[model samples]
Target chain A: MVDIPILMIGKNVVVPIQTELNDIGAKKMQEDVLYKIEKTTASGLVIDVSAVSIIDSFLGRILVDTSKMAKLMGTESVIVGMKKEVVLTLIQLGLRMENLNTALNLEDGLNLLRKLQETLHGKISG
Target chain B: MEKYQDSRDSGQGQSVSTTIFVASYEDVIVARQKVRELMNEMKFSLLDQTRVVTAVSELSRNIIVHAGKGEMTIIKYDESGRRGFRCIFEDKGPGIADIDLAMREGYSTTNSLGLGLSGSKKLCKNFSIQSTRGKGTRIEIAEWK
Candidate 1:
């Protein structure tokens, strides 16, 4: 199985899904992301899915679960770069990702992560 | 990969068809890619292609997750000026006992989101399912261009 690379910048980690991942691969990715977050103490996580063409129910669940798990680990997560068609399909599939945060692109995802980090820090400091 | 096979039958004014055996998660990806390529070659819109491919992924995965093994048949049809693609998924697993409950969204016996059947129905233009306890299950879905 191919391992999805997780890049660390500052206090955040960016995981760009570059190919079609099978079920095992996706689950592994989730585990890897969580491990990296814990290992690096990342305050923010960005999952870029621009290269992913399909986001079926299983993949959708993995994303939601990953974000929720990250939240429990004290890391904020944002999903980014979803194609228009993928968005439409995910909605039609009735997979409501209510707890997940999303952005339009990588830059926007990073910015959102930064904002989330600030709010979190503010709450702790103030 | 021993069970993998491909045979296309096309005749004058006849629908073209291809069958794929799905037994693992890798087969699910292959099935989705096959449907996407076929839809693209048929000039389907980008949105339609994505929707159909997503549905294919769900159904094929269902076959592996629920039945352990199954086959997917994709057919290209042009009937009376209406052109479309039809996908049939057949599995001989332990068959669903309650079709109604199984069709209900958010109701799953395997701890999944329970969107496989219901969501696939919404994605296609035409959808149908047949199953018998102790027998097997078959699902057919079609999308017109």
Candidate 2:
């Protein structure tokens, strides 16, 4: 129920939050994803939150926490393809998401992730 | 003379139109209807109307279930270029200590979805709350256009 594995499409990485990422699920997923990103040192992570429609204050706070987790592990997390209704809900809740990266769609998100990875690769190789 | 009388009476009518309410558990649905009608009179958009209704439902339910009793106030505001309403919910209940913890997802003090305060916050343009342990709590929510 918690800690689903990160998916790899070529070099792009995706983590889908399928249900309500409440207390226990959020904590467990944060640990697992942080570990995976640190181990792979992935260039970018696309968090697919499309499955989650209603994100309460707790879920929103945990999301902010998870993003921080990714940053500490040297991976950039980008949230992709949020429903407009959900966005409106989040804005209403005063859920501060200023620290997270948000993308409009999956392809655009993947492109951006790929770009980040390429840039990181160049820096390391150079 | 007729126009003068109409203006004076119309002004009085407008004041009467804007009435505040404090709803009990049984009165929450009616209270929500009143808020919806208020929004309609203000010509707020559909989304704004829905937001206010949703926020009202969540907050009112919280007052009933968590605090056992509470009071709600509806006031009109047009201070800024925008015009809308300000709703205040006050209750003498088990106050929220860890506001931050309470704000987190999945953290519910009751059997409810635990999304009451947070959801209410999201439903309005301006959301604020103040609470003390065993003292009481006050929530303010506003929607403007």
Candidate 3:
């Protein structure tokens, strides 16, 4: 369990979580994303959790909170690469992840971000 | 909650199960991995394993948020012929004052989405919980494959 890396791609900040995220790590991720959103001036944030092995309610809320904060800061956030079983489980846990945007995979998420950018400003820069 | 703890093994002779404590954020991850391995050993599909592990994550986290300390037990069950897994989460902290209110979606005592209890129940085939305000809380969920 090393640190979950957050990268910047095009006009988006991408966080590809490859391992399980604990409470401390989840909070750190939220803070890092918020700080980077301001520094990169990215229009969108994409989080790929395909490789993640687990997600609890606390981390679930942190994710939702992060996306909401990102939205408030003028950045759209998309979470992608969720497993089918995970989705079913998440639904049961009452965290629809509904409050946050989502995609089927990384490419779709990036594309979605592009479309969102165009729709938001009537321009395609990403 | 004791209803799921049937003494009868159904067929596999003596049953085998392991219990792990959940006290901190790190312990939450450990509980998840333990469940993941147990599910995998049971030959669960990738989706099934993920679903159960996700359930473990939410419930173990509940121990930390609500009780500040707790433990989880992973058990393998053989019923009338089907095979699956069972997990029990127990906490000694304050019990939920309202079970119905806690089960509702979007309900939260700590600004959370209020999904841990209700949501964990959804991921498995069977779910049950028992609690007394001054005592502790115990939750049990079972899935057959």
Candidate 4:
């Protein structure tokens, strides 16, 4: 998988969830993701988990927890491009993804982030 | 915690069920997935299913991550009218000192999300854990319909 650039499109922050984000390896990534959310104070976060083939219990739990964490930092977390196998494994394992919003592709995910940003902006302006 | 009103079996059956045992590395994700396969075959209730899956995954992963290396046994109980699953995960690493502190959130030995123990407790219907200082650790979780 190609390296996903942690770039900002408008006010939305995009992060790539590569294979390196597994188990303890995920701790560093989580820190970085958290830092971006706090630094940017972005309205939304788009995490690309398409490169993650397996969402183990720890990884699955962290992903879900990260979403909650993002909310606390004033950013909405959205996962994009999760494989069918990972989704099935998550379901079979009874992992909780209900709390997090997901999108089929980066475009859809970014759109939701953009919408969230617009809503936040509207709330602030109006 | 209030105990639910469910029939308890003292193991008075003649038939024996299949058991799957595996020992893996200190990788939480891999351990979690293995238990998920077993949970699916059990056909648990939606709520029970999620709890059991999370519980199994958490306990199994602990064996690997904390204990260094461990073994898990997945047992199927088909005898009698009550169908259930019984799992015993054992590890041979430095055991826990204070179970209470370990159970508490933000008291993790490792830099985990710290939800492995507490979240797992909420998921399992019957959960029991025992650990020694240097001996090992064992955790059992059972679910019934």
Top candidate on lDDT is 1
What value does DockQ give for candidate 3? 0.65
lDDT tens readout by residue for model 2, B1-145: 0011112243333212232334354455555667777888888865666567767766766777678777777766543364677777888998889888876644688754467776676567788999998987888887776
Model 3 Cα lDDT, one tens digit per residue, B41-113: 7788887887777777888889999899989987876555767777889999899898888877768898776
Separate DockQ for every predicted complex: 0.93, 0.10, 0.65, 0.14
> Which ranges in model 1 have alpha carbons more than 4 Å from their true place?
B1-12
Cα RMSD to native, each candidate?
2.1, 10.7, 4.3, 8.6
**lDDT tens digits, residue span B49-77, model 4:** 44565566567667767765676665666
Local accuracy of candidate 4 as per-residue lDDT tens digits, A23-110: 4566666777788878988778888888865565677777788889999888887889987765765555445677788999999998
Candidates by TM-score, descending order: 1, 3, 4, 2
TM-score of each: 0.95, 0.51, 0.85, 0.60
Better of 2 and 3 by DockQ: 3
Candidate 2 regions with alpha-carbon error over 4 angstroms: A1-5, A122-126, B1-93, B96-145
In candidate 1, what are the lDDT values of residues A1-126, reduced to their tens digit? 788999997889999999999999999999999999999999999999999999999999999999999999999999999999999999999999997999999999999988988898899999
Q: What TM-score describes the B chain of model 3? A: 0.87
TM-score of decoy 1: 0.95
Candidate 2 local lDDT, A27-98, one digit each (tens): 677677777677776667787878864454545666777777777767777888777766776676555688
Clashes of 3: 2
Scanning candidate 2 chain B in windows of ten residues, the lowest lDDT window is: B1-10
Between prediction 2 and prediction 4, the one with superior DockQ is 4
Q: Cα deviation in Å at residue B84, candidate 4?
A: 0.8
